[model samples]
Target: MGPNMLILASAAVLLLCGAANAARILALVPVASRSHHIWNSALTVGLAKKGHQIWALSPDNLEDNIYPNLTQMVIKGTYEKLREDFTMESFVEDSPFTFLKTMWAFGINVCRYESSTQAVKDLLKMPRDFFDLIITEVVFGECMFMFLHHFGGGTRIPVVGITAFGMGPWTDVLTGARTLPSVFAFPILPYVSKMSFTERLQNTLLTGYHWNNMIREYYPEQQKIAEEAYGEPLPPLIDLASNISVILVNNHYVLNGPQAQLPGIIDVGAMQCSPAQRLPKDISSFLNEAKIGAIYFSLGSNLMSELLPKDKLEVIVATFASLGPGIRVLWKFDPKVPIGHLPSNVLLKKWLPQEDVLGHPKTLAFVSHAGLLSTQEAIYHGVPIVAVPFFADQHTNARRLVELGVAVHVDFLTLTKESFKEKILNVTINPRYAENMRKMSNLLRDQPETPLDRAIFWVEFALRQGNDGMKALRSAGFDLAWYQYFLIDVLAAVLIAIVSPLLLIYVTMKTVMNKLRGNSKSKKKKL
Candidate 1:
């Protein structure tokens, strides 16, 4: 063939190859939280960059999502519904049980709202195999798993689960991963894995709460909502949840310490973390000009710093002022909130570019609420922290950081200017915290491939393997009943075997002794 003809032929083959590899994915992030959206966006956008077509359904906007291959289908007003009902006060004051109940309720409502959306309805109208794979946030949004059945038709569309935090007890059940209370802490509880008896009791009870309350009570409720939304009865949500192909959890063993995970459970923590970018001109100048160093303060998205009680806010303001002229404080404060006077060392912006600020060499320490994303970012940047955890897994994250020697914990409920200042200074002024953080940062960065890349590869692998190949990775333990899984029947049989043989031998010996005694009595009577 001529050169021109040959080039055209090669280009045609390449196009065919590209067309064959491209996958259609539906990414569901029904949890109405910005942080969760960050984790989901990383996966979806990363996949899109790799030539996959992605339709991301989320309640919140995907951060910096501008890919042509990726589209965002908004779940309208889901977050507003959350904001209308919950506040920072409620989060801090809620006990574990109350928090679990409240979260389950929110999850049910989210399922109803998401399933009713035009985007979901349109997707449902498509053929069962329309999408090659479904990636979803399974933390507080297991109800979204109903789409697995709706789209599965006869054969299932593979699903990959993602969570914005470490794998907890619920993750264990869903993925058939093992989590001993002795080796792994319950994510919501403020105890470490190596706990005292009392702490283990609490952790075990919390674990049971997942089975009894979440699986039994919460899943049933979500199942009903899913059926109502679909306008038909569907397969059980728990079964669908267990059918996940792979789980990309947003935690690393370096942070949470190591634990047993099934083959399908993958650690893709810090997927959202990236190299530092240039900050705004004004912010860059402020940090670069700091005489000593700077500190970044944020309570994450869910817990707003502006929502802090007046007294606590006052304490924070005063503490920041007393940090001395050399050290600058970039407090992520809402501009709308009025403050009559301000300290010269303190700067307030409604939103600061969090990762960029933490990545700055001038950034010395962080004052954080210990949200997983923030904690991961701090770990990535080698910045020590003053963890002022308020609720949920914040307490556990804070405790882990302290155990790792990279942070000092301060109780938010009992926060005072003195205590806050002390905690901040303990991490900032001391060289030990910085050294430990540097070591952690190195460990987290020393990976073979980026976490996002690993996540994307597994997703595409699932697409290629389809449902059956993914099913092989699922833990067989999930198919067993509780009694079977624990081997209660086997244990009972072994116990009976040993006890019955011993009892028989004892009865035989006792009968022979009685016969001997009777013969002796008869001889004595004859004499």
Candidate 2:
């Protein structure tokens, strides 16, 4: 064979061999929630399609019929289960107090489940197995961090942290971005979407309080488990994240309020499901008929449709009535709204093709409960929003959209027909809102590759890179303390010590000299 042909053949063989040797496997550990599960599932499917093996460990059970290749490990119970056990109704019933209590309970429940579960024990017992990489959810639980610290044995494997929501401070810590917040507080208002300044400060204090409790109470037991599993002294709590290679958040740069700086943190948003599903036939027909435009309304997964009172329902109906016959409203109502002389433009559905409906050309405005996924979907499709936030992070999400100038927030409590109509008309009539949405949409779309593609590529990169990837990750963790990052408190202390005492000494000397001079002057005058 010719020299060039032989070289080409050799290179092809080596490439094929490398492909054969590469066994990129991911562990999908997600907290139990439909929203979280959906994102993790999407990542799993995407990676698997790219010829990687995925072991999904979650509290929610995936139907075997759907995901045959994906190995499933059910955590069996969740914080929701514990909440039920603890009769947490009072906490949820009391608004802000309930929110704070629920977050506290959630943290406690996570610790409890980690201690109780056999899944961790069994997974740890596996014989130093050959898994190229690990990716697990950070928010739902910290078990993934515990597992990696225990099993990793300082043998470098790339660990990727995935967050179902935005890259909050906690996720930022994993990617070696900024240090994790010292305060580990719970949400103050469970029903309300946003926290007041006072509430935010209180939450910060609570966070510190919880962390102290965990360090004093919970760490000893956790350390014991780590020592037994890894046969070495566990690293400090802050140092546990040294093994993480990359952190992927299900948030777009356009959507996030404050951008976090982490070396390997990537925003791979709405990566859970492929946007392939077609709009339902009836919904399509309705939209087609509306030559002008249509509005889509959905409250998201968890909240029951029946929870909304009849008076509130009337306000919505009356608002839609005022919009007249031109605009269509596709309301995702539960048990169906009673058709008592309603507008011909309204279409009520128990469930709608949310993504497909948003993707439609005729979708002018989205009236949402401000769930993170719904918020992203609206932005992804470039539809302006009239956000009527109900609970959880919806208020924060709505406020963010409003800040971006793509949505307007209306209080659910004070939502009158006139107010709703006014907000809707303002959003629809204002070209600026739609224009800003389009700008964000373009930014979200302008990446070199699709979010799913980037996510898969990074997973493979983590696997191929291995211990070197881990070493890089460890180096990033050097700045994992608030004092180290900000240096504010240190600077304040130094300034206070140096400046205060010097000023005091100067004042005292000046007073003494003036008194002495005065005494001398009096004696001289008497003589």
Candidate 2 TM-score over all chains jointly: 0.77
RMSD each, Å:
5.1, 7.4
Instruction: Give the C-alpha miss distance for residue 268 in model 2, angstroms.
Output: 2.1
**Model 2 segments more than 4 A misplaced:** 1-28, 61-68, 75-101, 110-130, 153-156, 172-176, 179-239, 257-260, 272-276, 321-325, 336-350, 475-480, 489-501, 504-508, 511-515, 518-526
- For candidate 2, what is the lDDT? 0.67
Question: TM-scores of all models?
Answer: 0.91, 0.77
* Model 1 C-alpha lDDT per residue in residues 1-527, reported as the tens digit of each score: 99767755654454455566888888877787777777778888777766678888787776555455677887787767767766755587788777777777777777777778887776677777678788877767777777778777215678888888668866876876557777677777888778999889888787777667876788888888788777888888877777786889887988888777788889999999998999999899888889999999998877788777888888888998999989999989897898647899888899888999999999999999898999999999999999988887888999989999999999888888898888888888899999999999999999999999999889988888888888788888877876677789999999999999999999999999999999999999999
What is model 2's C-alpha RMSD? 7.4
lDDT of 2 by residue, 1-527 (tens): 99767755654454455455445454746465666676777787666544455576677666532333456777776746764655432232345444544554564456556545666666767655556677877654653556666446236466777887665545644554542333222423221224566766765665555445444644454455445544557666445655666778787757654354555777788675345366878888999898678888877765544456778777888889889878899888764646455678888787776888988888889998777888888887889999977655676677778877999989887889998999998888889999999988787777788888888877777777776754665433455555655677789899999999999999999999999999999999999
User: What is the lDDT, from 0 to 100, of the residue 214 in candidate 2?
Assistant: 49
Worst 10 residues of 2 by lDDT: 184-193
Candidate 2, residue 473: the lDDT equals 53
Off by over 4 Å in 1: 1-20, 153-156, 502-527
Best-fitting candidate, measured by lDDT? 1
